[model samples]
Target chain A: MKLFLYLDRESVVHRLHPVTKLVALPVLFGVAMRLERLETLALLALVVVVVAALGRALDAVAGMASLLLTLLIATTLMWWLFAPQGGLLRDGFQPAALARSAGLGLRLALMVASGIVFLATTRVEDFAHGLRTLGLPYRVAFALTLAFRLVPTFVASGRAVAEAQRARGLDLDHGGLVTRMRRYTPLVVPMFLTSIRRADRLAAALETRGFGSGEKRTDLVEHRFGGRDALAAVLLVGLVAASLWGGELASQPAVQAALGSARAWLEALYAKAASRP
Target chain B: MRQRTRPGVLPGSAESLGVPRAEIARRVAECLGLVGLAGFERREPATLSGGEKQRLAIASVLAMRPSLILLDEPTTDLDPVGKGEVHAILRRLAADGLAVAVIEHETEELLDLDRILHLDAGAVRRDGPPRRLLLEVAELAAAGVEPPVAARASRWLGLAEVVREERFADEVAARGVQVERTGVRPRLATRGEAPVIEVDHLVHRYPLRDQPAVDDVSLAIRPGEFVALLGANGSGKTTLAKHLNGLLPPTSGAVRVAGHDAKKAGTAQLARHVGYVFQDPDHQIFSATVWEEMAFGPRNLGVGEDQLESRILAALEVVGLTEERDRDPFVLTKGQRQRLAVASVLATAPEILVLDEPTTGLDYNDRERMLALLADLHRRGHTVLVITHAMEVVASHCERALVMAGGKLVFDGGIPELFANDEVLARARLRAPTAWRLGRMLGLETLTPEELGAALRGGGGGNGA
Candidate 1:
């Protein structure tokens, strides 16, 4: 029932200030976005792995490993069906294109992994408070955080309604597409009603605590940025700058020769598969 | 984000319009600690119990350290246990010398409060101590407040009903109230030859829980037996009941329902023999009209047109919603919607019915109506299993009681035996019904006020039923 991904862990990354962790997310995403080769992305992936490992967030990363792998394979296959790049294959299904797509997929997966680590490290309260400090409107920040807060509740109620309908003999599994869709009516109506009721209650609960009175609010949580956070922020910005500028280092003559050999090896394997009975 | 409005300057509340962020955080934690919700800081309000939410709401206000706190019907939406929790907190707050006032309808719970202000048509009608105002039965009834059971019973017995439950029991025992004696445990009714539902060594674990939700529970419920599954919240009663209808497959051991392996059989197949009513009626009643709601279950079961009409009509008749067959179900009162939920489940014609907290959030008349409906169903040859915290309802209506604590079946026996086992009752956080206490003090095995009164007045016969 705990569908949220905020893992409770005490680690260096988790202990970092919310703004420190928040800045790391976009910086890490920038590093992943600028790199285009597996060699460079592997180093970036190592950085991610070490960060996640130190943060005790590897379990969550491992949980999504299969999903990331699927995206990698699917993106590579999809790129193979595109027009030939560099004219390396007859139908453009070449290793260069495959490597590009694989790198693109890995970049996306790494971005998502960093986002996951950020979530695992940062509580939703800190995230909202960070936004509030960053000059976002309070209502907008609350709207964003409310989704994270209410999803588990919404899902729990939906599951309850589904179970109730199943008890009443509304079999949704062994039905045709239309029948299944129709059978979901009993579950949907109740979930909708529950959400509305919850909304009404939430409004009253908020109102009673002097919410929407536009009075200045105070919080029990203090997101402090200390010397360690400043150090972390500088290191993250330098890392992003280095990764963006570091892609050219992969195109040096020696690295290009190694890449050519790997591409040749991949082409030979594709030829062998194409010629199979 | 809660606003900071200083009602009074206390340890955490500074006299300022814009409180410091650190101060607010400190005050929030301090208030939560005061209200016994220190570690539940991040829990979703939806996942919290009614009592917990009420406590959280109180903590939100208590952070202000207000000199006087006023609430309107705080326990209205809570169950007996939840109401008890709120009452205890109120008493504690009052005892702490904080001024507290509550607009309450369930007057029995607030007897310990120092004063009562009875309002009639927006005017102060009666202002006195709880002992005086609550005992004026006629005026109390006219004021639309349910006087405590001890007060009503004492009035009927011609004793000065100026009594709390403890005093009533002491007074009745002091009067040398004679009582009829039978076996130590009341005689259980003759049950069916075979149990319709059987759970053997069932252990249920959620994906993330450290301990099993239902740990090694084993019990059987026979046909035509009105059994109460009593437990504190999250004590595995609902988890055990879910196994009966094949909604939850046990992680270990086996559950057999009516001679069929529940784990192997599909839930739809199990629905043919057992129907489940959820705690909230809105979860099940989805149709626009009452008639359609009644027909939904039977239609799902593939009841032919030849029999579907009669089945739906029979169900509506049984739950007494026949006249509102075409009315929109959403427009019905909560009590009627609850009955509609029962009717919808009954439309499937299951022999065994399991209701989860059916009497919660109901007025006295609706609660009685629901109990009468269950009793009627039991009479018509249905095995009824009710998962509830209402000890009084269990004592009066159920033939047997199954008490659970910490996911273990602590006690399974007759009502009086369950109450007499103080350890089990304490483990389950259950209080015995007032009638049971009064009757026990009077040396009888009665479960209802009528029965207890009759036995106490010496009705010229022995009482055991």
Candidate 2:
């Protein structure tokens, strides 16, 4: 209901430059990667909590908690237990090891929490405008925006197809996996086919609207970078720099070895994510 | 002064290829469905379907009378009925010694084709006989395409000779008939007046549009009354309906549900008084189970779990989906999904229900089922305001009608008045119902089939009654 329902209002977060939020994601990403310390990640999580509160996105946050937690746990386990030799398990499962596991979990949680913060705060058009500002080609940017926009659109289509099927008294539930897939195959085909058709329309529409002419396009809600925006940007960059510097400053050779290991694990995580469609 | 032409000269390529202008025109007409348009050759490339573009791609090649035909997703946008016709045409073309290369979504429609090219993400995943590719490959299921309904049903029911295509089409056709029949009227009487909802000078404006989506529209609904709001696209019908439940604040007007001013009311408050259903059922359906979906609105309003159970069951009963209470709404058929949406709203028990374009893409049977549900709501004394395009729906279910033309309420009266005025109907971009059209053709006075049927039988009861 929340996904499809309209919640109309205007707020400062809504009015911010989409590019500001977009750039904020990578900054947070860098911070999460650099800030291997548990305390620093906890502070980042606190900042996210404050932003979610301000944006009135607590409900959305709570709704995504399970998925976020699952991802956090999965990533932490893969990083700590499965990333070659000398992990937390190698040191044995004791209070100190548990505390280290908690640190890994907290860092992953902060990363996910920050992502939800942006998604809940940003509108579809705001993100598109941000991409445009970043000098992404309009064709690709518009396609990305349209793809996001089609989330609700295709959901609507899926509902229609389901309803049409139901009205015909097709029992979608009383079937085996293969049977169910077979039953829904016709449904999925039509929707997939419709999406391709919609893509064609979108391409033509974008072309007609002068999407990729290398001309500046005005927006309905123009996102001007304000003094607060500059301050926020500076603050984000500072945090990432501080995290890396702090991790390096901790002189314990053991800590340095762990940090090196974490970096390798993070690279592997990114490789896996990039491999998916 | 010209020499005689050679006797062996070929006719124009279009004619030589047997690609009659009439066939192309017919295919275009069928694809457009009820949407009117001129010939495709004159239209812009921007106005064609992905399927149409593919067809045009073939048509171009075929125009030269090439011995080969390459097809891809030919009936993508086409409905079930259209898919059969197009498939048949393609088969005929193949029989005529034209080498046809076809790529399609469902194998059912393309089963009889000479060959199949199985590609997954630009790679030739498989190249084989249709029987081997379809029967042996477990990967086809993972690849997200399925055999025709007949094959599926046969496999499921453990029955031989049940081909996938046969079963699938039979299911589709049977469903279509069922939906059409559901449109028939149930036993009901004209509603009593209680003024359940009222609007005075309602207006709304989109952020950028010059004209208000809704403008100075004043109307009222009595308790248990079924009223239909009729208008063309962008006519403000949806905007006006949204105000009934406080989804939108009137720019400069008043809206009251159950005598409470909706402008000052919160959506939660409005939810208790007036349940609003969006045009798209997906807008309201996200819960995993039917029961949970029915409980969603009420739960949002802070109803306790114990009370929610009864409310859920009662609402499910009202929508005639009690049997499917545990099923996933996403898995339900089109008509069932709509009922689930209605049930979700009903669980909140609002005094008034407002629906936007409730029958936009519904088949005849599903439309009937919806009409029956609306009739039931009216009988149960709930205020029902339906925004619709179908004149048949207006004639049958709606007692009162409001017609908007260009952001103005040009007509507000009984349903009879709506069908009687040809000029007003034209201005509203509405066609008269079939009965009304027939009556007009025969120079009769009434505007509905029931009225004409009554008149033909010499019954004197007022058709309005």
Instruction: Tell me the tens digit of each residue's lDDT in model 2 across B1-465.
Output: 111110111112232233444453344344333222224533433335334544444444443455766554565444233345566766766787778777665565554655677888899988776644554323665675544332333333223333344243353334331111112223234456657788898788876357787878887778877888888655667667767766668889898888789888645567787877766565445557887667657765778998989888888887789999888877898778877877788887887888877765554456667888889988987888888766667877788888887888888877766677878887876666544554443345444445544443342221121
Q: Residue A218 in candidate 1 has what lDDT?
A: 51
Clashing pairs in 1: A84-A92, A219-B25, A220-B25
Tens digits of lDDT, candidate 1, B1-465: 222222111212221225665566577678777777776755656567667778877776776667788898787655456678878887888898889999876666867889989887899998888876677876776555656666666765556435667676666556565554544555777675888888899999988778788889888888889999988777888988999989999999999998899999978999999999998998877888998888888888889989999998898898899999999999999989998999899999999999999977665567778899999999999999999877778988998999877788888888878887888877887778777777777667777766776665663432221
In order, what DockQ does each candidate have?
A: 0.37, 0.01
Q: How far in Å is the alpha carbon of B342 misplaced in model 1?
A: 0.7
Give TM-scores of the second chain, every candidate: 0.86, 0.60
Name the lDDT of candidate 2. Answer: 0.62
Q: State the C-alpha lDDT per candidate.
A: 0.78, 0.62
Per lDDT, the best of the predicted structures is: 1
- A37 in model 1: Cα distance from truth in Å? 1.0
Off by over 4 Å in 2: A1-277, B1-194, B443-448, B457-465
What TM-score does each of the candidates earn? 0.88, 0.44
Among incorrect, acceptable, medium and high, the docking class of model 2 is incorrect
Q: Interface RMSD, all models, one decimal each?
A: 6.1, 20.1
